[model samples]
Target: MATAKKLPSGSYRVRVYDKVTGKYRSFTAPTKREAEHKAAEFLRYRVDTRDTRLTVREVCQRYINERSNVLSPASIDRYQRILDKQLSEDFKDTYLEKLSESIITDEVNRLCGKYTPKTVKTTVHFFLPIIRKHRRDLELDDIRLPKVFPKVKEYPEPAVIMQLFRGDRMELEVLLALCYGLRKEEIRGLRSSDLSGNVLTIRRVMIDVGRTSVVRENAAKTVNSIRSITVAPFVADLIQARSGDYVTSMSGQAIYKHFSRVMAKAGYSITFHDLRHINASVMLYLGVPDKYAMERGGWATDNTLKKVYQSTFSDQRKRFDDMVDNYFSKIYDTNI
Candidate 1:
């Protein structure tokens, strides 16, 4: 039930009692009759909200559907996995509005014990948006997350990457990753038509999703990802020799399996993606400008160049330091 109150502006304000929250919800109407009508609608809405038991699972399903076209296929798969695997079973059936910070925090803490800190962080990251959109009353500030440490990405030496490039099975894949710093999906996404003279356009990426091993073709990772990169003459020659519409016929999983065997046989412990990191390290070591390196590697931002993939080989750093030391010695000798 709601009551009407006369306002200073001569408008009738309707106040409705929200039984669930025990708070008064107010709405303004121009006339007393309109105010009463508005209050009745508010009470009806309160009843409907309580009757509708939309679960977290339902909200997550809706979220995925809404974001399917916007997010990359891989990202959508990740979100689905988080909802199904990472989130606790206790809350899946709970109503969206009924969830509290304590319940979410307990679940997150339990997940931290089972999963890595990064995985737990990802779970929380995906969970917040759903509650924000559906349960605006649930305050997220009470949830305390565990401390997360970033894992440092280690890159193989330039010589190690070169050695992989000479291998027979994964030669082309290694070359594309090492030379252009292309991601695994980007390497798999390359097509013959993408090659125009010496330049290669990266407009799309191939993503492997789900347990079924379905490969989905999607647009580039970001807006800046759709750009052209000039290939070295050797890379161009290799592309010219390759058959099929795409660069390599092997799927990303197949390439990874091949790369693992190649590394095992060669007694080097490096992942396929290490080749891309090696390319960035070499570029930074050779004093390539940040902008040029970002553009050449299809990196969307300069921060990624500086923070993510800028580790130089220790030997190269030593050589650079020695050069500086020698130059300073020469200057001192001239002054003396």
Candidate 2:
């Protein structure tokens, strides 16, 4: 432990040896005890792995291995997939010490040609953290990545969405997504125990990794995602009619395929995930407050809620505007 010394400027500074940098690092605070405490805390949790011989791929694998117990299965699977398919062999083989900003930028630019801008951005974002875990001193600022444009998604009216799946095998799935804004994973993870009368609690999630589905109990996409919402009478009846440990027996893939096929036949090309947009649109259409809508949809922030709200159907906006205009016109005529 290094003792803190008062400087000419009247600030306390402590010099602590960092194993990674092979040099003494400085921690400064207003008080002598605070400076020493800061240095001591750093020494307590400092990782001593200063292995300069590790390659980029090796560091990524090491990170993945270290976080295996903590990270979700789906996250691990996606990381592995990115390591295998997204990373270039040359980039992976490059030594961590030798990796430069230009190398990362070049790889990102190359990936933009092969994959979407969003995919390229995701790959670079995931790769950067692996590098930084081992080499904290590296400045990876302003590594140019492809710009991700906001995608315009079209969703059908709530009524049409209801009519399409009414009395069908996937009706329960549709109702859960549209009525409650429950994610597909949450829907698959639902069990009879999760339903108590008309109130359905979203507590678990089932994510697909490779060919199989992995269920995580008492877990969801976010803390806000684990919520309880009152279900509609028809939705409650549908859940009661089903006899199984899980509410819906369909796998994630099966649900997606069935939803897609049904939607395709109706001449609308939309995904099961888009039901959430429909849910958001309905909330916006019905003038549901941002707070309640966000809670129901498991949105962590109002930013996402505002995006969906702003993207509400053009026709619906026009209809509402016209109705208001007609009402104003009638009032003006009465005054004359």
Candidate 3:
């Protein structure tokens, strides 16, 4: 607390330190009480004004800074990328108090023209929570966002994929994804110590943040993602043969590039991530129950397993449908 002092002119003056401006602010009045009250009011107004004047970019950065210790490196990197690249200068510079639905809607519309609906949605979703943390009065319910349609991905047959990568440099990476339904991060984080006999434990993940890779020990995408599953005999042998602290020394980029080249050479257009889907598809084809499949794949919920991973191969679906149609056709002919 600061006290008022008598001035040479018989008036009272009070000085208070403004930490935000790194300067002392002075208030003068005819009386000591009035001068102290004026200084108090000015300090209160300064704090309120400063908060209202905070820009979107500033608030977002502050939020990221405050949560840096708690948030994963991948998450921090994503937020930083969004702050740097995704947000428009106008949107970022807008004062938090001036933020409105119209402004947000315009930004979203602008994003839609340049990016996919999913990307626009992700950007908006990431931006909104930071705003709400500061401005609780802001209502976002009426903001219309573009609808995101699920992509129908076609993956190569398990046999074809295995045959292609059997002796390649990325065989272990492919095997982990295709056989165990491991995410690329999990595949990259695999260590020699995580393997015991035929069982392989998924206890960590290595994610790409900008140009660098970050490893999170005893951490995974989800609680269920941290699991252990038995590997086949041949898979175990491959693991045993690898001589390093990690199962594979290849970086995520190298694995993706090699996978893309192999798939392209085989006349298939697919991504490294598609191998996880192929694993799920194989499980579905073999009549594996949802419970077992979910456990094996480390999926958090049945809904996710069914919605994203569980898909019948086009050829397999056609073959099964054809069998049913033929049976029905024979019955109709007999009745006729």
Cα shift from native, residue 131, model 2 (Å): 1.4
User: What is the lDDT of every predicted structure here?
Assistant: 0.71, 0.79, 0.79
Q: What TM-score fits each model?
A: 0.72, 0.75, 0.73
| Candidate 3 local lDDT, 99-211, one digit each (tens) | 88789888888999999998888888888877766665666788788899988867766667777876788887887888779999998899988999877899999988889
Give candidate 3 misplaced runs (Cα > 4 Å): 1-49, 301-336
Q: Is candidate 1 or candidate 3 better by TM-score?
A: 3
Candidate 1: give the clashing pairs: none
Q: How well does candidate 1 match the true structure in TM-score terms? A: 0.72
For residue 317, model 3's alpha carbon misses the true position, in angstroms, by: 27
Overall local distance difference test of candidate 2: 0.79
Please rank every candidate by TM-score, starting with the best. Answer: 2, 3, 1
Decreasing lDDT order of the candidates: 3, 2, 1
lDDT of 2 by residue, 1-336 (tens): 979999999999999988777898999999999999999988765654555478888888887898998999989998999998889999999987777778877887789889998888888889887776666555678777777888786777666767777678998898788766789999999998888986788999998999988999988987768777767556778899999899988989899999999999998899998887877776776676566567667885646645544554356544543443343234333433
Evaluated at residue 45, the lDDT of candidate 3 is 45
- Candidate 2: where are CA atoms >4 Å away? 1-16, 21-50, 136-139, 301-336
